[model samples]
Target: MLGELWGTGNLFRLALPDTFLGYFLLLIDIIFLAAILLHFSRKTSFNSIFEKWQWVLGLSLAGFITSQLLPIPLPFTNQSLTPFSVFPLLLAASFLNPLAVLIVGAATGLGQSLGQTNQLFDVFHFAFTGLLAALLLQQPFIGRLYHFLRHPIVSGSISMILPAFLLGLSTLVISEAGFSLAALDQSLYTSNNALLLFLFEGFINGVLVLIILKWLPNLRPRQTLIPSPTQRSLRRQLIGNFLAFSIFITIVVMAVVFNLSISVSRRLVLNQMAHNAAIASSELPDFQSELERLVDAFDNTTLFTSSNPVEAEVSLEQIYNSSLLYNQLIVVNKELTISAQYAPGEPEKLQLSEEEKLALNAVFTTNDRKIVTKNSSSVEGLSFIVPVMDDGETVVAVIGRVTQLSINNLIVGIQGVTTDGVGFIVNEEGQVIAHPDPTMLNAYWQDEENGRSLSIETNGIKNGAYQFYESKSNTRQLVYYLQEDHDHKWTVVVSTPYAVVLDLSLDIGRPLLIILLVVVIASFIQLTYQSQGITEPITEMVTASKTMAAGGNWTPSIHAQRDDEIGQLSQAFSQMQRSMKKRLNDLSLLLNVSSDVSTNIDL
Candidate 1:
């Protein structure tokens, strides 16, 4: 079966699974397994049924068949809860040597490969797990300890769960899946469910093995008497418990402090962004109102009444050159033709597209001031349109001003935004009108490449803070936005990288961490010094007891100087040792007298 599975080409699929790293890892696993097989073959003898080729092959086949055929789907995950197919391999660990266990493991992997492809790491993971179980069971002390406990649950859990857990952990470390508290949490509780599934399978397999051992006692491995546990000194127990408690408390306190600091820092950053956003929102309308006033003033000029393009052009030029805010100033007559236009430095004829002409005509017909924002490949800016009227009744022409740099300057000049942060204006349609980067101008704010939408729902909210991942920089950003009601509704946004907040939190935590380190070190030193006062007398008593047991003098040389329990105990121990020596001396004298009396009687 193993040869057939291997011949199916599934086992060799791992040789090149998408990357050179996969190939390298496959080679390493193969070499390590081969080395284990070679080393164990020399050291292990095939004297047991578990080591027989027939039993190993049969168990391997069973494991593969059960795993492939029977799998129960786990709730809320793609993972399947399967029968513990590796039960036989774990059972074999108890009775056979590591070599036999590894053989079965490899055969099982071969069979699994026929059914599942690209599980090269899994094959070695199972093999190493079995090897570990076998090595552990083969130890005399551990085997005897398991026998002494005699509880199938305890025995099964130890032999099966421990090795499986260790092997799974090693696999995690070696695989692309990282080994950290965060990674483990994500794997167990989030999308990656491998770790939890592995442990669940191990536990089920352990129980199954325990049941089989009970049903077939003859198949169980022989065990010896478990040695008694050595007693620990009072001083050792007290010191160990004290240190463990201290460390545990320290960890708990540090975790609390760290979490609190992070929470507070994040809140402060959010609040700051919100405040800055509000200020920008207020400033936006004020700037827009000023532009509207300027356009209105330009509309009341006499340049629109004149038909001569040169005089109108000269007047527009003076107005355009007066302020850096206007990119271009134009005058359109009732026919929607650009009569005159002026731009900085070089004068060019203004050509209006049909769409732009219709938009300007609408303002002329309405005879009202209107704000029109343009966002396109060739042009990107806002156009403020105010109608020029004849004798305060009929609309004659429209005077308009196009400005891009003014709004960009307004957003860039907003105070309280950090140098690394960004401030931008998004129109009602979610299109960015002004930004620090010219390339980003006119881009959709919600576009994935620009800035993906926030994960949280912001419905019915006018102003608030939120967070979203910025794909451009691959960093999370803390964003605060406020909707401004001006000539056109606009959303002013201020954002900074979330890492800055984390750095601030870290700055806050640094002192706490240093204090924790110092406290731990001081506690350790103090405990060592204080424990010596209690442990030294007990250590001497233990040594004296050992000497007395070996037929040497038992008196302990301990100075009972301190007025404490340990000192009193030391004094008591010394008195007891002296009494024991005197009794021994009396016994020796009595024996000498008896020997002399017997000699005299014989004479």
Candidate 2:
């Protein structure tokens, strides 16, 4: 929305209205896809995009790599691939490189802005966030962040707030000073109204990147997978106390939530795909009518309708136009006379070899209607057909060929597959069309249940349901099914894991999981520090007690600052010291009493 406001007379066409938005967005999407494809191609051909310290770059590289190898082709072009921008920065911080972390953040924000829009501030919004992340990684005062994630303000209000304000300031100031398009920074700040929101989201993003960074090291084939778990000589035990029950309950609760999420995601995918399939299927009749109309026009203009050789060949040449999307649309008779409505880029000479001529003539004579596909080195199209016939039942001339739909759309719609999870598509053949797990499409994917394919009409179960099926890989697949008919019949299956389906209600699990992890780490650290505080006081008290018992004059010293359990120890130490002094005096008195008594009693 902000882009449109700034894009008024903008060069990148960013600020387009809805009517023209799709076109502009499409152009942007294509450019984005192209940039990704180029990136992927360069990485696959050259070397690993991974860097040891540059974790974000490695991940962006990995995401790009995965996208490159994803086998999900584009809608119009078969030669292209998609790159998801989320991974690289995730890799950057996760693996411990502050610089890469920043770079990844910048790249993702920049990529998002570029692909989805032409807005300048949008690019910098991402860039600014990334830059600050790098700065924060080294900031000396940001320790309390490592403490707990429940609140964002504790880790220095300035550290948390100032960066965001500056990011907005930079965008507005820079745009006003240099680019005309950058002045649109209002949306960025306004959306994240609170400083807490900014820091919480930003820091969480940073930590998320860190966690992903943790996993990437293991994923990297070149790097050693085993973590040399820091000799953290600490064997942790979940203590059997009040806390134990809470921990168990948390696990069970999470398990239930996970199961629920999977179920919901499955239902949503099925419902969506089924709706799309119904619409596509319904539109087929209209599409067919349009094709028929075009075919009728081509037939009347060409002389092949009369079976005249010379007239049909020469006259049809005049019937061709430059506006058509095809190079040629031809009507041929049994006599080999071709009346063709060729398009603008067509060669001047409309010549055909005997077999080529006969093949065309035979299609008119025999099949009544035949569809042939030929992608010449110069031109691209499929030979789509609806034969034009005469009243005598004998095929006189042919019309209706050459379609507008692209090959990539054909492959995806015709052969595309979705599974029981998000963004997954499965084809009629039960092959993985699109899935979150890359290996689900590949034969080697883990979880044997995932790789298995369930035939649609199985065990007398018809189509359309949230149902369970099995695959060749012995994986059980939960899928919502739909059939898509574009140029041909194809299955449009929407599926996610039953777990993912259920997870819709619990999308917060991501942040929660992060919070839980941070809590566990913080708890461990707190336990360590608390134990240290206790150890010194306890040790001093023990020493003082032992020294007094052995007849040594030991001064009492138990260091405890607070009036808690340790303070009680300090008070006890003082009492013990006084008691030791009194005991010494009593011993001396007893010696005198014994000496006097011994002399007197003997007389």
Candidate 3:
């Protein structure tokens, strides 16, 4: 989402650029805009240009304001429904020419990008949708067809559907969800709520346009007409509207609840990981204390400053035999030369390598305990170096414990790391000193050859979480790491596969889905029962009217029993039928009386 600006050494360095490609692309965009202007300038007349520009700029500003400040957040997804923002561009396409439409679209896109910090590609999405709308509404054949269907609602709704589809498709293409059905399905399952949001926005925008046109009749396009409602069955209309609104509400509610459940579950998992990291970090001081205690035992002995190598070796062997913590123990004199050494298998004295001697010299110079990994010699593992002093002033020798496996055991024994998770320790140099996988021991943590390259600051960060791709498992992992700033200066990292988080979310979502299903079923049944009450009386009236139209005697049988609107209608129908029958009988009687008088006159 970060926008790259072009910097120095570029042909057109507009700002402090992050990359040459971004600015070069900007230059190309400028050129393209100039070309579009040139093409439109000749075809578009300057007459009423100020009036047209007013509409373009005004609508663009409205669109920007609505997009930034008035977006309606949708439930169940991270997307906000911004149908109001699309209204202005759509209005432009309806009233103004294509040139104005394009300009307004571009300006609105720019403003939205500035407000939201969206990627540059999103601007194209807005512009393209606008152009599609313009073409649909302005092209001769389509425009005629649209006008032929004079109903404003139909025209507005149909105009929006294609543009909405284009916008959704563009969104999918620009994102990780390429041009694939499976990817789109996965995106809908995950976080891309926009796919449904766009389509919903289209229908909502259509209704919005209808309302606007009704309020401002002058804004309605020429040759377009709003027709009166047809005399359809009111019962059917009532039931249909009720069902539609109920279904819409049900979907929105379900989506919101499901997404909230997933979000809560994910947060719980993150919290658990953090708690585990804290617990693991709390145990580190104990490991450090154990190392300090081992060194303290040597400090209290005369083996460090003893001149006889045989005596020093005997003492070192005894200590090593008593404690299985270390594989090798050695004493180094002031010259950084090994004075005594002990290993379980090696009976003779072993000469120290130059690298080992330098390491010991560092410990002697610093006069402090240091933890290091020694891979330069056969006694490779984590080493603990302790400095020895004569009378607390002059340095005599240094004692070292090599191949201490206690730290490894401590890491492997840490609780709460799930079966699909791993916990390990890495030193300040980003070397994995202790890991469950022995092959990864002493391997550079950032080396791709070890499976994948990790770019985390293991030493600098105190505690944090990272999501990274683990090539070994070929899956994404969420890693929580804690750094302990002791003599060892090591980082403890615990990682669990991201799939586990999704699985947890699914476990939480299942119950929410069941609840939604039950609610929807209950609502449907209730609505069906309520609707029959309204429809049944209307159906009886419709049947009576049909009988009267066919010249049969018909009466409102239930008019006297009820006082609601249906009863009133039936009462009016019954009175009109009686009056007509009385008028017909009187006229027939008058005609017979006239006929008898004419017969008497003739006699």
Candidate 4:
């Protein structure tokens, strides 16, 4: 056993600090002092206290015998189970007073420890267990629990199950703590097998207790021993009404504040998004101009001027290496044949797609730069097509750079503005050209099924608008869009969900509600305590006055501690009682004299 205490150095070994141990001992001392005070104040007779002792002691002795004679052995650990020892503690806690319960617990722990290893640690273990169990099973809490269990409409299974479950939880704590304290082998204390055994034992003990209490109905708590205060005064009623009114007003104020805050927050978020969109619009044109200049310079090189595929290949590699943006740079000849491909190992004479061919024709015919986007199922992304003009101002070779617009990366500044804010770019054709979600790319701006569109034409707006769109998931999104008029004719879209904004409002409201609840509870407790100071004295005076009025030779004096209005009333009542007693005496004396004169006359 000594070796087990120090061996293996298992993880379960609790390195409790000395200061914590000192504080724990001090707390226990305080609790014991409190219990003593409580016990003496109640002041039950010695015989009654002794009778309780006898019952508890006998139950402890019985449990001791059972544990020793036929000890239940546990698997996976060298520990004997003695759940029966809990019976005395439970019994003492149920019907006996607090002091009696403690005594029973101490005795039972001592008896069990002595019978087993005679270890001081074992005694403390059982004693601590008893203390916790007794504390949980005391007075008002137990009374309330009993009432809940025995309600008229409650089912039998429910009544039994609830109590049993609660008992199991309490027993689990005791068992775990007891094992930790008594365990010399830390490995055994931390083992899964040990935990399972303790759980089983706790559950079994709880079920057994329920069965025992059921058979011995006397052990169960029937009703509350302490009487509840019943007197209600006008002041008390007013206080209650005022508290209710305050709570109602607080709730209404919070609701109004929440609505106002959400409105302001939503407007601010929309304004921020609009600001971000404008910034992106200004910045994107600069990026477009820079890219177009690069493409034009590359077109003027010997690579495209000489129409040499070999030279163009080398020049395209240099241009692709210049920026991180370009995925591929292609040089198309006057015949619309791919002269050279920069993105590695492609044939020199690749045929252009019908959409690309059409875009090439428009670039030559219009003699202006055109951004052509492919919204086909197989193809996506943008192509910037610029006409390479000869000295005679005729369109020669067309220079186009194939690149996907990454709105997710470009619009990263708007991410922290709102939790659910999103930004995307749409082309003139009303196809989603650039979006954070890859699945939405090349998909039409209008939902085919819902007929929801982002364009002003579909929404019946001239330039810009904020429209509500319900997705396939039935979630409503607040979309704010503005058209970019710089060479691309693309629309910049920023959106967020209405629910997310509302949740933000609720987030602020929840803490306020909690604060209100805490304040109300604290106020009620304080007011109740304060009310007692005034009401108790008044109640005493009223009772005493009633007794005096009923022909009893008694004086009413509250002897109020405070020098308030209640104290003055108490003093006046005392004076009135003295005066009334004197008058009654005078009347009695007169009656006696009259009676004596009548007797003389009769004689």
Pairs in clash, predicted candidate 3? 5-17, 5-18, 6-17, 7-17, 76-255
How far out, in Å, is residue 558 in model 4? 3.2
Candidate 3 has its poorest 10 consecutive residues by lDDT at 5-14
State the local distance difference test value for candidate 3.
Answer: 0.61
**lDDT per residue as tens, model 1, 523-600:** 888987887877777788788888888998765576778778888888888888888889988999999999999999
TM-score for all models, in order of appearance: 0.61, 0.38, 0.54, 0.47
How much lDDT does each candidate structure score?
Answer: 0.63, 0.44, 0.61, 0.56
Better of 3 and 4 by lDDT: 3
Per-residue alpha-carbon lDDT of candidate 2 for residues 537-567, written as tens digits (9 for 90 to 100): 7667767778777867666565567788778
For all candidates, the clash counts are 0, 48, 5, 0
Sort the predicted structures by lDDT, highest score first.
Answer: 1, 3, 4, 2
Q: Please report, as a residue range, the 10-residue window in candidate 4 with the lowest summed lDDT.
A: 179-188
In model 4, the Cα lDDT at residue 258 comes to 76
- Evaluate model 1: give its lDDT: 0.63
lDDT of 1 at 496: 81
Model 4 segments beyond 4 Å from truth?
1-236, 260-279, 294-325, 330-342, 345-369, 374-380, 387-399, 405-409, 415-420, 427-431, 443-491, 497-515, 545-553, 561-563
Model 4 score (lDDT): 0.56
Give a tens-digit lDDT track for model 4, residues 302-323.
5565656788777778877876
